[model samples]
Structures are given as structure tokens and as C-alpha cells.
Target: MPMPHILGADHVVVTVRDLDASAAAWAKLGFTVSPRGTHSPHLGTGNYTIMFQDDYLELLGVLTPTDQNKPTQDFLAAREGIERTAFTTDSAAGGAAELKKRGLEPLGPVHFGRPVDLPGGGTGEAKFNVFRWPLLENPGGMRIFACEHLSRHTVWIPELMVHANGAKAIARIEILTADPKAAAEHMSRLIDEPAIADGAVWKVPSGGRRADFVFLDAAAFAARYPDAVRAGATTSGAAALVLVTDDLAKAKAIPGAVTTGSAVSIPASAANGVVVSFVAR
Candidate 1:
């Protein structure tokens, strides 16, 4: 069963070195990138969001050096790509408390907001309350966090939902780990969900209309995404992001995208280290 306060997958944070350049790169891939939004001074970060129906992707970059952005800076020092994934929660505090009950220590119920330019000629604050799983306890070599959107309207703008690639929602997130079973079990403990074994892969469902987290060994990952260009030299961590699109033809038309049977994939080198694949829903 899922955690009481924890909903499902919310968004994935792709840490990039250059904010504007990364946004332009995703735009070239046919995604409708949102206007840049800067976080509060304490956070020292800015981002552009690729909005979908329920979940989204955040292109995050450091604007100034601060204690809060140390982890992000460290990750960027190595490579740019998905540094962490967030889960949806109605109450960050409640989620944290539940995590404590499960013998896992959560980081914080941090409060922050970004200024958003509303489509109807007004400005709004996209507020959020978030709490993270222990920083050092990176399951499947990726950080996990839970987010509570205080102002959903400011974040999920309808104008930003349309994409030229016809992408609708995140279908799945694939992680390559040395021990798929161990990785899946660790994630299961964090999310309070069961990890089901399927051949060489282990699947952890995020519940609702969200994506599943699939963990597999290197060989299985290679077999699954043969044409994908991995981001870093490391064999562990997030491997691919698959999206459900309305039109496969439009997705295949993206510059530099390769058609792998029924799916169209954008190389990780172009997408800040995460292989992006599009499949018709």
C-alpha cells in the first residue's frame, strides 16, 4: 500500500549547468517549456518547467552559491541530468511524520516559492512545501523527495501544457543499478509500496495516473534502451525517461531524435544526460 500522505510521482528535477541553454535544448525536442522562474533568495536557484497533465519536468540551475544549493552544485560539478525525483504529497509535514514512523528520517518540510507570471495579466507565487528522504540514503543512486504544492494554479498553467511533440504524461523512469532487487527494495521502503519482480527488472508503481520506477541491471538496461546515450560514466542512477505522446510521428520529427522501433528517443547528450523516449499512448 502507498503511504497515507504520499500521493504519487510529481516531477523529476534535471540539474543543468546552464539554465537558458538547457531550456532551449528541451524546446528543440518539441516540449513546451515554461517561462523561467526564480526561487526565493535562500534557494539560489531558477528553473523552467515542461508541464504535462499531472506531472512535469523541472530544468533546474544554480543562480548563486548558497548552503541550500550545495548538493545541486556538487551534482552539476560531475554532470547535468536528473539529480532527484519528487513525489506528490498533500502535506509535507504529515509525510515526514509517517516516514519517521517507518524508521526513515526525512530531511525537512521546507517552504519556498517562485514568482509566476499568470497568463491573464497578473503575477502569482508558486508556493511549495517539501520534505526529502535522507540525503545520504540515495536509493538507486538518486535522491527522493516529496512536494506539497501550495498553489497548484500558479504552477500548472494550461498554456504551458501543449507540446509540439504531443507528449501527454510521464510513462516510466528507468534506473540502472548493480542490484536491481536491492535498489527496488530500498525504494519500496521509502515509498511504502511493493516491488514486483518481472524478469530482470523490478517495478515499483507510483500509484494513480503516474509513472512506475523500473530498476534493472546494466545488461537489462542496455537491452531495453540499446540506442540510448548515457549521460555519465557511472553505470548507476536514472537511465531513461519515457513519455506517452499523442502523436508518434511528431515525436520522431524532433531534430536528432532516433526512431527505435515504435519509440522515438532523444540522446542524453542533448537532454542534459537523461535519454528521453516518446511512445504513442
Candidate 2:
């Protein structure tokens, strides 16, 4: 039997408290969104709009009062800091076979996708022949799911960036936590990578042609970039995705962080930092 191939990082999702606020804020970070958008009425999946790219950032939060007609623990209120790593794949059957053969456990092979009409007058849908970490039955810990696009789009960001012929950038996504070793080990096990073997620190490579994943402790992350901890982000289970930029003043032009004192220590070289509004911290 042939082995199933593991794809690179898909998208990082940060659950937020307010949809309108976060959507407006993230737009400044170079994300032009899609026309189709809605907050989940059932599972909180409806309360978000996604920006397409090689590695897109998902701004997720709670549904508004109108959407709250039905009660659900999942999206009724946004958990303070829980960060979920969402992934997608082309071959769910192939991946499932590979994992099962290896005696690995997965949460699900649930299918959730939508259809979009073509420009000409026909309709096509995105299929999710994928598996999730914590299955739909038990959507534990920040909600994880796999997406399988049926029809490919011309403007795929993550694919373009990953398969770029030139520029080997984004060496790794350094995730900070209090337990560097545990976080590293868990993610490593989930994604089939090596354990970090230290206090909350691990490195998972995106195979030969992909960037690696590096998990670090809060203290270590702060040490590497002193501007982080001082940013006044106080969420429970999320991360501060400090994207690198060239224009600091342009970002500083934004009005929120300055008024709320959300970002205090702007390391001269840290570009213009924005408090990840979706994460609440």
C-alpha cells in the first residue's frame, strides 16, 4: 500500500469575541475577504469570514444577538484564549488509511462543505473529504476541522506561497506557551512530527519543501522578542500572531491600540504590531 502524504500548514484560526470589530481590524493586515460570509448559527462556524491564501488567518468569534436565537455552548460566547490549528487535505481516504495502518487515532472523518455557482450559470461545491483531530461528536478544545476544496480557485494563497519556486521564507511558525515541551509533543504526535522533549518547545517540519513548526514557551518567546508580553494581551487559550511588516507608522495610524494601551513596547524593529483582536489578548 502506498503511504499517504502529509500536507503543509493550512490556516491558523483565532477565536475572537466580536465579529464586526475583528473583521474590520484584520483587514489592515492585508486580508481582502470574500463576499460570502456568515456567523455560524449552530456551531459558531457561521460567525466568521475567511481570507484566501497559502496560509490564511481566520477571524472567528461569537454570533450576534440575532444569531443567538438558538443556544449553543460552542459559539454563544468566545472562549478567552483557546487557539485552534485548522488543516485541509485533498485525500481524506488516503490519509485515514495511513493513520489507521499506523494505529493512530483521529477525532473524525466528518464532511462539511458548501457549493458556489460558477460564473457561466452552473454550480460547484467545495467538498470536505477530510478528518478532524477532535471529531464533531466531541468538538473539544477550540474546534478543529479539515476542508477539501472540490474545485480549485485561481487565487490560492497558501498553495502559491508554499510552492513558490524562489524564496524559502517562513522557516517555521513559533508557537509560544507555558509548557513548551508538552505543546511541542502533543502537536508533534497529532501531526506525526518529532517531540520537542523540553519545557513546551518543539519543532515540526513541513516535510522537505515546507516550513517547519517551532513551539516555544512564553518566556522564551518574550526573550526572543521583548515586545510581546508587554502588549497587554490577556486571553486564555490563544496566541499572538505578530506578523512582520515594513510600515510601522502606517499601522500606528490605526486608532484602537493607541487608545486602549494594548500595545506598549513597540521594539523599534518589531515593525508595526497589532494586538490580534480575534484572540481577545
Model 2 ranges with Cα > 4 A deviation: 1-3, 36-44, 47-53, 62-82, 115-125, 135-145, 154-172, 195-201, 208-211, 227-238, 242-281
TM-score of each: 0.96, 0.62
lDDT of 1 at 5: 85
Compose the digit string of candidate 2's lDDT tens values, residues 2-30: 12445665665555555566565445433
- Model 2 RMSD vs true structure: 7.7
Worst 10 residues of 2 by lDDT: 271-280
Return the clash pairs for model 1, or none.
none
**lDDT (10s digit) by residue, model 1, range 205-261:** 887779999898889877666644454424678868999999999998898788877
Error of 2 at 127 (Å): 3.6
Identify the candidate with maximal lDDT. Answer: 1
What's the lDDT for all of these models? Answer: 0.89, 0.44
